[model samples]
Target: MPVSPRIGLVGSQGAYGRWLRRFFEQRMGLQVWGRDPVGDTALSERALLEEVDVLVFCAPIRQTPEVIRHYADIAAGIERGQLWLDITSIKAAPVAAMLSSQAEVVGLHPMSAAPKSATLRGRAMVVCEARLDAWRPWLEAFLAASEADCVRAEAEQHDRVMALVQGMVHASHMVQGAVLRELAPDVGGLDAIRPFASVGYELDMAVMRRMLASNPAIYQDIQFDNPHVAPMLERMSAQLDKLCDLVWRGDNVARDQLREQLLERSRDYAGKQSVAEGSYAFERLGYLLADLREPRFISVFLPLDRPGSLRALLSVFEQRGINLDSIHSSRSADGELLFRIGVSRDGDATALQDAVRAIEAEGIGRVLEASGIA
Candidate 1:
């Protein structure tokens, strides 16, 4: 029977590092050791190099290449059966450095952050095999046990995909936040109008918020360190310029042609069924208009501006089985709260009336204008 491989992970103090260490120790019940240059740890570089059958660099994107290079001699001295792997977001440089070592090298990018749930059951993991001779079976079995969807790609291919996937996407969010700050200079300026935001707008803002809240250095490294990102950003800028020019001209015929071309390209890229399911633009305007016409809009005024009031009002609608098609809330000039809510005409009229009365009776809000009844 083959002996289980002893694993050593570098940078075990970071978030991803800690998560990975716990996963290997607690979940897999593997004999795992860790080494952090800055953190107080028992495992030294020499100890890890001499003992572990597999060494994984779990350092930041910027620091990974240096770590691989620093330990290149130690890795080269390892036995043929041992392996060296890196989990950097960018793969090309680190993979190239790891290939210098005599031991088999494999680059693993877990296409996601550390595991938050019970299992990494269906997450995508990109495996770039630099020199996987003796360790191929071992790595494959480990991935299989973890239930990850392992995608095999060349190092160059992985970096190219990440240049767009991580690089361009992050750049777009940063640019958007900068533009928003330029437009709204005050603190909590854009968020102040969040109550009036549409679902799509809210979703976009949520992604922006999440990204902005993360460590800036990490995003900066992912964007700047990727060699293929500069060209991708240039292409993205050209496309943006083309759209800007078309919009500035306000040419309806040209805009319509552009829209059709874009839709066709999107359908080609994502497949017809996926585009149809995901796009609201594909829906006929007449059908949407008909649905809107069948809804009775009820506008209410709530004096309270505090939190949980909105949830309370929504709870009333939920209990009454009033399906709210649209919700628009804003603060009046005199600092009062105004909410315009839409419910289907097929809904119970008595129940809707009761919901409105309950809010007023509870002194939460009053009915300002109840239209669309006739």
Candidate 2:
């Protein structure tokens, strides 16, 4: 472990692997190599062991412990003083396997999907430092480069928290999706029901859809590979049974029990400030959903990344006296920066169309979509 370690990724073809590859190369200016079983990676296991100072296991959770164990056996005493790290959903087993290796070991869990950005800015990262002697400074430097809100935890503690945060939440949503699928036909499928959905319903739908669209293996591994998840699921099931029984009773005593168990007792556990913060967050999200649902908006992609590009685009709308309701900018999954600008509902549609034409004609921005207009 020098001032900058040459990094080796065990699953460099995967989503988080690719993201970390870019972060190492562009953000930290580090030399890197990767070996993936599914693809033809540049480095072999032996090559990675010999070449890189830091080895990161980014393989799926199910394969991670075995991967670490294989590497540790082959590189016995050879990887001593080198750093071994893993970015997996569950930490206990992988961290344990790595501790058996000669390398300095740590388990990392980033609290997000591979983002479009180069760094994990504004996101949380859990660090389980199993062993560190000489590599401590470099590890701190690496974490600093990531710009994550790093929280230190023991490997066992990390797995327990993840069981609640990821396992229980995902299980509940998956069950909700099942319920929706079974009963949607009674009210006409999702498309028909979505129109009348509350903001909370729409928010949950977004989370459920995101899980469905991603690689099924990632979610499957989270549920199965983590040992703590079974107890979490059992507790969730028991709570549902209690609620169901309370609903069936349909009496004053049942109502009191529901209030005490579901509301009062939980609120006391969660604390007043936490509930207040959650309520305010809900209101903010409700406002955003309302604005988006209006559909009187356009998405634009500006070709130039220069300063005046956005102001010039705004001028085109100003020229038409078309006031915007809201404007938001975000990067696409592929990293293209795009803007979504909402038009006032009462604004003249023809003027907005003219603005779109002018912006494109003058090369200010290309309008991607114009929803909710004739």
Candidate 3:
């Protein structure tokens, strides 16, 4: 079909680039040719510019503007009527460079990391439509396929908001992570700290751990590359210092000022409704974490996708009289569905083992993992 456009990914070896490659070729059924400096068979800039119907810049934040500028210079009016898009976190500069070409351009920010899911179904994606006359319909189609909650904003506006939403939050977590790095050793590492962690701390640690686990360059660039981050960080540092001074003073006047500046002012700024919604969301996350903290669980994979696949798996536990605390489903990296069934650890531990044995023996499902069972 002529409607199906061949896709060109500029930085194909990067995490998001690889994800985009899978998304385009497998999800959208479009042929994707990638050109990455370190990976993929080298595709010439000329070939990519001339051949691919849609060219997406998935390059690193620091390199994106330069890459776009080079393409724009060499395109030489040949870029006319094509769709050029970038998925950089910071938008203004890359969008500006892309605008140098005649192609229809848009800057996109997914508001999250490269996800495990096939599509960004639940994530927010910011769209900055710099140029979009002829390719508007095609762009809409791709956005729809991405399944992201798309919000439109100007390139300058997107950068400003990310300075707070992304940059500020990341810097805070990075600070916490640094403190944890030192204090963790003093307290015998995270395993020792885990028992005393509150719901909020647990949540914060999850964010910090995820940041530490991923590519350091991404976090570094989020801080260093964003122009707005420096001023934002200064404001944050001032507030933190104010808090420290208030605590050190330890007087009623200081306490009142702390309450006013930290609590009352913040609540007023965020609004009662927004604060209420955030609290409710946190409560829900706490409940999910509570369910997951129980170590007594079995992860099973159903080989068949038939009607009774899940029912059969449940029947094993039902017949064994193993009372389940919770049941949750997740996908493997390969997209195979896995069910994590939590059962009462207080009840007969032998019965749980029996269920695992029966599930494998009867071909109900494969026990991918089970606690207290070899």
RMSD of each: 10.8, 1.8, 2.0
* Cα lDDT of model 1 by residue, 132-191, tens digit: 776777777778776788899999999999988889888888888898888765646876
Residue lDDT tens for model 3, 195-285: 9999999999999988989888888888898899999999999999999999999999999999999999999999999999999999999
Candidate scoring better on lDDT of 1 and 3: 3
For model 1, the superposed segments whose C-alpha errors exceed 4 Å read 185-188, 260-270, 280-374
What's each prediction's clash count? 0, 0, 0
How does candidate 3 fare on TM-score?
0.94
Write the residue-wise lDDT of candidate 2 on 309-332 in tens digits.
Answer: 889988888889998998888776
Structural similarity to truth (TM-score) of each candidate? 0.71, 0.95, 0.94
What Cα-based lDDT does every candidate model obtain? Answer: 0.78, 0.91, 0.90
By lDDT, the best candidate is 2
Please say which candidate is ahead in TM-score: 1 or 2. Answer: 2
- Model 3: how far residue 161 lies from native, Å: 0.8
Which model, 2 or 3, shows the larger TM-score? 2
